[model samples]
Target: MPRRRPNGVGLEVSALGLGCMGMSQTYGVPDDRESIATIHRALERGCFFFDTAESYGPFVNEELLGRALRGRREEAVIATKFGWEYEGTRRGALNSKPEHIRRVVDECLGRLKTDRIDVLYQHRVDLEVPIEEVAGAVGELIQAGKVLHFGLSEAGAGTIARAHEVCPVALLQTEYSLWERHIEQEILPAIRERGIGLVAYSPLGRGFLTSTALPAEEYPESDYRRHDPRFQGDNFTANTAAASVVREVAARREVTPAQIALAWLLHRGEDIVPIPGTKRRVTLEENLAAVDVVLDAEDLRRLDEALPPEAVAGTRYPEAVMHMNGR
Candidate 1:
């Protein structure tokens, strides 16, 4: 397995990480047996970094990851987030109050069946709570040895600086792919300046770049992508066409479009890690193999021209959800 140290933190992880969110909710139904098998496959293949969040499945995703890592926890680098409030399975509101952060960490530790979280992130910028306070709360956890590293998701450049000042942030989890390049203009530079690494989620454009994306209407209402503007109506058609460049490159290189997309992110820098979510062992193997798909300068140029920021169709999220990003 290829190993990478984000921001020179001396914390080494597999070049490709496993995103465990899909196993419990979103995209489709839950399949415990398949998901556990997939996790075992990932470990066998040397892909150990696993990401989940409290809001995912409103709680079940952590439990699922906990169960999967049961006897073999020592071999994995677990990363999970907390920032949202939940009423059973339904999401309620954003809550990152200092007290809430402390309480959530305990609950997450319990759910994950681990004494420490390898990396703990604030899922989103809690506008209700100041970034420094959130950082301080996480800092205390780090001091207490409950979390090994701290991360932020979808935070602005200024917010990242503030949080890092309070507690050195090890990574920033956000959306980045051939179709989404908003961070390149500002956030990327800021993190690079501070020597912080990036954890690129939705690295496959939510599976759209893989040429297997279904139209929004095809998804059940229970699926979160149904409400995502990028998957709806004309936007889906336009985005699919725009992402064809990935397929073109894949055909030329004799690799899957998903591999092409992941390879593009991997080539961006050693500090950047892409966590592509999958519940099937076959897809997991395919995603992990992307580390070997080398895209030369010409291939990189073609991909850049193919999916420029303007080429994408809709906002990454609906209004309410979009409001929470880059805060």
Candidate 2:
């Protein structure tokens, strides 16, 4: 039930948002009934910041979210993104051209069943189209009253600066967790200086920080983690070992490791809002509980020492996907 304001954007949301990606794709099979139920439970718990994207399930995820929010729209803040060129679930090249951005926003509005998007982000920077143009396109949408705020995902500092100059970016969604701290080097400072809030995705190391995570090989081929380097081979072992610190702290605090991991993010700054994805009510409740798990200075120091930026084992993404991060 805790609330956070992203970089003084004047937009407040639940400290922990619901990441609606895995409910429709990537992690495993789709479970619409449960996904909707989880979203409802999130609302009941006062966790009203829900994140989705046009690329998630290529389109179905937004539809599912729309269905979930049908009668309760005003109670939740919806955040979704656009960037990838996808048809159904078959993804193609990245496209953020002015025309494309306009097209995508219209479709997203339809799928979301909403007139205004609480926050609309460019999923990934489109090198083909200048960042300024991307920002301008979103600015136009804002003027049209289609988008309430603008955001960028996995964008480098330079890109963020350029875009914000054209139009103030309310938030920056990127991969940030105990294992992935690359943003701290430059991106984080830049966004903070610009008063841009951060939305931390994969805050639990994509479930690696949780006890339920299995070796890469144990995941089904359809699971994205099966191909993620951090979850594969020796890297998985090393990362799992690194995450033991989370377990130790959780045991001492009498909290779940997931809570420990999420609380660590919450401790970083109020400017940060983490959207941990889940398709079940149980996991959603557990993640929401992180808002209450306070990490004092000593606990913060121990966690930082335990999983220092360099300590994490593999790159956060594979080579091909890594290239698209705009960092």
Candidate 3:
């Protein structure tokens, strides 16, 4: 038999979902052929949910997913995000305007090769636009059979409440991990209360907690990890120390550091699902096996003490990216 279904609001996904961001951009140049193969591999392994964003590779990622899911669409659950507004020359910034939302969903459907999005998330909270307007737009898509579920990314508790009033949010995607526990204070409570599934992105702490990621200088020039404070300067040294603690626990348990990081999140909540990004088969396998590494109460407490919420040094994103979150 397969693993138990992880419930997310009204939808059900495999216990583990694949994060398709790395297959498009972020880490380095990605080979489309290899990325497609990886997506197929995930399906073969029984992973039903795949995540991609319009902002990833600036629309190129959705196209990539479209190709990968072409004839095999029914084998997976496809989730794509919108909300970034891009004019001809300039890159995209967030725009959840009702008109723009309609426009972008058409474009995303064209790129995704699908009639309806399985789960549609607003890439970020657009403060200038009312949450009700955004919810109203997605709600219309649901009624029109263009969208199955609505979601939000990095939205605060207040915005989530307001949006839920308009249309029940199916999921809330945010950066939550052992190193980054800010969501635990308010976001998790709100989500649990409202029965919204929490999709934890960057759940491996952008590979910092995985221990396989080396120094910033060792990363490729195109890699975005270089821009993260935890991967730069003295912060890298401090961050490595935190990984060392995880490594120690993993060694004793005979598991990889990546598994330890992911397993911790699994123990966090049944409603919480982690999407750890990886480009290679080896890393992907390492991540998938995390579901089997059950962490007992003692294990959870020790791991928490080893890397406390306040212990992670520096911010997860740069100043500009940081400003974009939690609106």
* Candidate 2 vs candidate 3, lDDT winner: 2
Which candidate, 1 or 3, would have the higher TM-score against the true structure? 1
Error of 3 at 17 (Å): 0.7
Ranking by TM-score: 2, 1, 3
Q: Model 1, 126: alpha-carbon shift in Å?
A: 1.2
Off by over 4 Å in 2: none
Prediction 1 global C-alpha lDDT: 0.92
RMSD over all Cα atoms, model 2: 0.9
**Local accuracy of candidate 2 as per-residue lDDT tens digits, 8-27:** 66889999999999998879
lDDT of 1 by residue, 149-229 (tens): 999999999999999999999999999999999999999999999999999999998888886889899999988789889
lDDT of 3: 0.85
Global lDDT of each candidate: 0.92, 0.92, 0.85
lDDT by residue for model 3 over 149-182, one digit each (tens)?
9999999999999999999899999998888988
Alpha carbon deviation, residue 304, candidate 2 (Å) = 0.7
